[model samples]
Target: MTDQTRISVGLQFGTQPPLNTLRAFLLGARAMTLDSVMVIDHFQNVFPTSIWDRDLTWLAAQRDTPHEFFDYQVLAGYLASRVGRMRLGVGVTEAIRRHPVLIAQAMMTLSHLTARAPILGIGAGERMNLDPYGFDAAEPVSRLEEALQIIHLCFSTQGPIDFCGRHFQLHSAPMDLKPARGRVPEIWVAAHGPRMLSLAGRWGDGWYPATVVSPREYAEKLAAVRAAAVAAGRNPAAITPALHRFMVVAPSEREARAMLDTKVVRAFALMAPPSLWRQAGVDHPFGERFNPLVDFVPGRYDRETMNAAIAAVPSAVVAEGPLLWGSRNQVVARLRAFGEAGLRHVVLAPVSGLVSPRAALYSLWATGRIARSLRRTSPGDGTSAPLLC
Candidate 1:
């Protein structure tokens, strides 16, 4: 398959201190056929104090604090020096913290550093990143729409920008910076809901959803994105369909299932909102509308609170759609299914690595093998090549 038709797989990881582990992982990854490397941007981590301590003990040992998220842009610039021709991007950054102008400037600067065009993953503000710093988090989606417009204007407009919107007002704001060698950064929107999906088609060059869903459900979401793009008079196929999900791999499906039952793995279910827990006949300790991804404040919950929430997470979630895990062949088959659903790009990270040091090594090895198999096969095609394992 040609570049445009071939499947693209990327990695998403944090760039905190003790870069040796991450750099080692990337050194091994350099031999793989990865298309991109994405770093997450967040002022605060989602995990509470106790859960973080128990899971990421290595990081905890190195730092005074359990949660330490280095600035993504600074780390991305550093990473550019370490990586090869792979694309670089923040997996998803809030449009609220930094003004659109600043984000545009940062992207432009990084564009000169990387071999390929960089990506700017924009998403509506999350509470942990917003409410703590006292930034205005009200009407986040609406704010993000205005931010997208201003960012576009900053990159596309030749002269100063003069625009007014409900959230921001720019009076001839001068942003005359040009792209490095005409390589404009692509904006991939991390959209989930209907309105956010519409915004993605209207402004985004790619659609990136982190939620784990069946291939049919993914196709449905992609259809909505395409429909919205067509309504906006844009070429629907030009928008890349991407997914970001967590994984846990083992030699067999049963082993993978057992790995999923660990305390670290089960805690991931807390990332889902309470509304989802209710579907499984479980009550969220935080209440019906509580969503940790959106509303969780780091260092807020004690051990008991976290344990209560983790206990409330039914076994069904571990054996369910969101967290992808299985044997190598099963994982390849699942990814092939997603490819058939119009998934051109995917970013997966191993959640089971949090279990132990041995599990971490296996996770890296298995993930590398998975990346190789996908790159060799013609995904989205009816047939798949033999599993690499």
Candidate 2:
């Protein structure tokens, strides 16, 4: 006997493709009932400039800039018309760049267009998205807390909203758009820290953490979220337990593990805080007291510095970076273990695809197989989204 909810699988492309390519991609996805398609919002990426010139990703050779990103909100609006029946939204966008009221309005608009419940994934602003553009990255949790309050106020009521807080102040701001008749928009917060986790419980429809945490640690953090929900007099069950995970699938376990030593993969590990690097007896290039990934500025590093830093990262460190890797069976087993830890929804990113077209094709196929193996569904359940299977 098991108490697992009907788990949903979602696909999240790490980068945006050309308009025609994206349209065709979604056309294919329309055949499956995937829970959601999440777009990443970023001005700069986690990968350093050096990797862009290498064979890390196919987009490298075609790019005008090493770090190029289309506006996620605009892309979401375009996708609303194309994604046949699946939910569509950005994985996480901060209120730091866009005002909280605007985010609320955008969610309201998308709800009317999409056939399924559209999700609004929020997070404390990332440094790369903020620092270069002159936005204050300090007290991000506090700012996000206030932003959530404002956005929540706008959605939960139809009246004028007035909120006074440390990071934001709103005076009788009018936001009067209602969601589709029966479709309610969801807010998935990317929370990992203690204060952020509590906010996820109090305000979010889903606790969508992107960090790499052990299943045991996920259970512990999940419990904290539930406790916070209970303290707020809300049903803890209302919040979907969701995660954003990176995976690598190859012909063999050895090949998969070997892929972790690539420039992009090594850079991914470097995105982790110095403490994680320290645990593996590796020195973080940015220094022991360096800020976390969310606070890191990737654009500032010269190619030489980035290459040196990435070279410093060992494959073993990447393996223990908490990223999922291995042959198909190993990957599936790990996902199943996480599913047992109350993971109801997950957005999977296959990073090995960056290595080559062959790796990408194999990973794509393996992902479908992996999804079919782990996601349980009732027979004849027409709503079951294809996990790429």
Candidate 3:
């Protein structure tokens, strides 16, 4: 593995934190000089209710209630105005919920507002966001493929568009707005499966996969992406390899483990299919019980049930998964391993107690420390500097 590589570090802002907490974290990140900030695009709460409250009866009562989530585009614009230096973007938005033209226009607007082209991360539809809203969740990959094509046309083409696909169609669609930076925002695609990986290689400027993927798995998938890029006649090096994972920085290993044992983290792990757990070498207790294919419901379980299920799993098993939790040095070492494994970008999603103001501030400080350590120890003989994007 060559160490003469550059890595961009990003922080992910999701619905788990309240708006105030998110604002504080962003301000702290800017003060600490982190590279970029990305926000998740979700109409509903992706975090389990247990994370917010531990009381079983209270959780059950609020299970049917809507969760708080800000619109990502609007939030990105807001954050951009507040934090002028840090690159702002939506970690990912689904093509199913919003049209390609609108997404393109929104990104362009963000670019003009921020004075830099924001990263537009996209993915196929997730059932959690689609099913309740009555959007067609079928053939998500097909819809995503067509959506990518349309989005590309909207960004690159000069005149009106006329496209007809199985899932979406456009007839003389007007896309008159040009990007403020003289180019559209870089499109990053979140993909896990083989088909989606190929699409990322062929069309995306960056490839993003969930953090549960092991470093070895990331290497394999990245190889596949490079092959697909070569087959498509695009420069493979142009596609940035980005990984999104939850992180917790603590003073000791035990404290880190305790933080990862929260109901939210356990429930999040349970939502991953058993195959992914096995791939990550996680010995999860809920084998095939909450498989997305069989369960069909988004999240699969409510707070009480998920809490019970997570309680049965061993902490060691959870520790073995993709979460980055440890002392400062340990966290830095793990990140170095990932960089060695061909990861060019990493987006850290702080979990559990780290979402709190005090812990989040500490995490930001630790992140600055880690970023400096990576740069100092990075294998290149002090000649090539890693780009902070």
True lDDT of residue 79, candidate 1: 80
Q: After superposition, how far is residue 377 of candidate 2 from its true place, in Å?
A: 6.6
Candidates ranked by TM-score: 1, 2, 3
- Model 1 spans with C-alpha error above 4 angstroms: 1-6, 55-64, 273-275, 378-389
**Cα lDDT tens digits for candidate 2, 1-389:** 04474456777874455677667556645545566788888887776675577555665876645567788878888889887778887888999999998998888888888898888999987888898899877888989899988888877777888888998888887788877877778899998888999999998899998775567777888998899999999999999999888878887777976787776777777766455677778677877777556767877887788888878876656776557778877766566566767888887778887777798778767766666665654323222322211
TM-score of each: 0.92, 0.92, 0.86
Best by lDDT: 1
For model 3, residues 52-167, the per-residue Cα lDDT tens digits are 45332233333353366778887887787876677788888888899888998999888788856688989886777778778887888888899999888988788889999998
The TM-score measured for candidate 2 stands at 0.92
Q: Identify the superior model by lDDT, candidate 2 or candidate 3.
A: 2
Clash totals, every prediction: 0, 1, 0
Query: Candidate 2: minimum summed lDDT over ten consecutive residues — where?
Result: 380-389
Q: Candidate 1, residues 111-139: lDDT per residue as tens digits?
A: 88888889999899788888878899899
